[model samples]
Target: MDLFNPYNLQVITFIVLNGILAISIYITLATGQLSLGHAGFMSIGAYVASILTKQADVPLIFALLLGGLIAGVIALLIGAPTLKLHGLYLAIATLGFGEVVRVIFLNMEITNGALGITGLKSIGSTLYDWLKVTGLTGDSFGLSVLQMKAVLTLLFLLLLFGLVLFLTLRLHRSRIGRAFEAIKADETAAKAMGLPVAYYKMLAFIIGAVLAGFCGGLFAHITTTITPDDFNYHKVVEILSFAVIGGSEIVWGPLFGAFILTTLPEVLRVLAEYKMIMYGAIMVLVMAFRPHGLIGTDTFAKLFDRRRKQAARQAEEGM
Candidate 1:
């Protein structure tokens, strides 16, 4: 079978996009916050980006960044009052916030009410146009335009994911990450130590919002259309499941989980009516047996350390 076929490529693209969304939620969870409002931020980004690109004729990159920044600003506003709530209360507040956002969009005249937005260009098409303008058509790359577009789209998304992953890794090792961990472990003690608990929580919330917004921008461009229903509470649950099933103890877990869960449905398509039933059963079993996910904090670390020790033993034998 052709792996690069359009259907497979679309699925792979969504996997990567969902991986980004998983990371977005992971950022908030890392800070001991249970935010279910990322879907709201995502909707803000999608609508803003769609409007800018479709109406203002803005460039794709600028539209995405602006959309993300706007979402961050909104997060700052919403978080200040709401982050004070803890545990289930915070989750409920955020979930309510998401529903509110959907309702607002659904009624907005600029968003065409419930009709949503469409006719926006795809990311690949935008890239292809730029390439042609630069005198670098598909013929220049010795491939058809469609193939060239696909390759560029994949490469661009991979680069974007790598950038986010790199930043997350840096944050994981930074003082801020430590502060987040401390807060997660004991908020009262963190505040006692004068770690600026509110500031860090707000910062984490804004960062997650920005990331979700960025993901939303990409989602809009990739799908070339978006609606209020797209960012509902169900989407919030799906995004959260990625981190939960993948093991949120480390950064890699959510991405791994996103890949598995996103691709599993396609793999199980042969099951027809039983596809969703099997999928739900698998998730249930994974949660029951491997509560920490398939990869916890020490999973990869232990594997690597064991391999290193085995290599050392072989070297000693050779000597």
Candidate 2:
């Protein structure tokens, strides 16, 4: 059915990008913190990476790392003062901070203000150029230059997502992750246990900020340009919705959610004028019927626990 068409390719690329964004929000939510401002951190990363690549000629990898680091630092600064606020208060503060960041960018000369930045380098084009320089063109790769570019870009982005997923899973099993769960379940009890609830919350926020920044850097390079508008409150809401709608209890949930939501619009294109209406209705249904998301943590936990018990019983019976 021509699944490899250019339009589908672009949608796949965006799915990877949005998956990263969803994971960012998931991290904070996992720690019981609602950060409605990750898009600001993302914008910071995008601009920093964009500037580094366009001006200083830095490598994309290094630019992305530095961008993430900068965003983490900013998160630390912002989180220190704001993380103490709980629930709705924290959400409002983060949302306000995002607005502030947008306003600042809109007035900054370095960012070209509201005019936005363009003419940035595309990772796919960059790889194609590199192949030409290295004399490893279609003859060696068994694919056309354009085809190679798409394959390489997809693989590169998937690798990035794999790393993120691995790290998130590892974090879920770590001491810090246990503390995050403890805090999320009962912040008061965690504090009574001398767990430093505030510190853990701040740490989660910073980690989420770093990941969002990294994703932002990649987004800039992939699209080859970006405007402040791209990382606005609407984008923040959309990214957060991914984690919420997907189920933040498990790392895979957000990735799955990102894939479904990202491709839904394209798949519904046949609906024409009714597509947006349908999309909103679907989200509303999900929220109303599946508040904990499509994937329920309790259900997954019970299923896995049952399997574990069954496996142990089988082993004992074999003996």
Candidate 3:
């Protein structure tokens, strides 16, 4: 394929998809709740989308949404009961849940078990066909549905980032943020403050899980392929890597982390094995050097305060 061919667009598309994955991980991590089972939600999204299309002849776009809905429902089922668990236990439960999803996929006949889903119609192309049904295929370029989806994915990622950021900022600044901070600092204290600790924790989980499901939908359509192995514990670790790297600055922290780590693997292709080694090293250094996290609010506040002081000094000097 040509270098500038549309195939390269997949890489761009995945960066955005993975960015969303990183964003989803960031939400729970911010609340001091570490969920290691993002992959289960993602797998649910992917499989549901594929199954709906393959079995009942569902349209691609609707199937993608259905996949996300399925993931959210599963998350609600898993998250609601488990919200009462502590950090370590919650992490374990999520990880175990992911493993169960993987195992179930491995044994399922319709999913083709370990062989995985294949020959599935690309959502992009499917959209093209559906669009043609409504007369929207276009006059020139004649772009296939996959290309259309890639374009839409890129645009959607930007929109999602904005929407997530806006909501997160609001959440961080609201009474909820203080509650989240209190809970993160001392759950007992938060409860003493009359906060509904369980409810908020569940809320954060639902938000993050829904977003994970959304990202999974993007991944489902973009890759148009998935396997049980794709949603394993290692994936949970990877998403955590993104959250850790992004810092805890409410929003941009995770976004920054996602962008850097998402592209890190490709950037260090030469190092190959050491690339992963170096990635770990970087994470260690970041955690050590900036333990609160790469973009934690504390670090951001310090910088903001410094700038404010500098601005005041400059204003006096000009006067």
Clashes of each: 0, 0, 7
Per-candidate TM equals: 0.94, 0.92, 0.85
Model 2 off-target regions past 4 Å? 1-4, 302-319
Candidate 3: worst-modelled 10 consecutive residues by lDDT = 1-10
Better of 2 and 3 by lDDT: 2
lDDT of each: 0.91, 0.88, 0.76
Q: Which lDDT tens digits does candidate 3 get at residues 180-226?
A: 77888888888898999888887778778877877776676666677
User: Is candidate 2 or 3 superior in TM-score?
Assistant: 2
Per-residue alpha-carbon lDDT of model 2 for 1-319, expressed as tens digits? 6554556667788999898888899899988888998999999999999999999999888999999999999999999899989999999999999899989989999999998889998888877788789878866856766667776677788899889988988999999999999999999999999998888898899999999999989999988889999999888888987887888877777877898899999999999999999999999999899898877677678899999999999999999
**Candidate 1 colliding pairs:** none
Flag clash pairs in model 3.
124-145, 124-146, 125-145, 125-146, 246-253, 247-295, 248-296
Model 3, global lDDT: 0.76
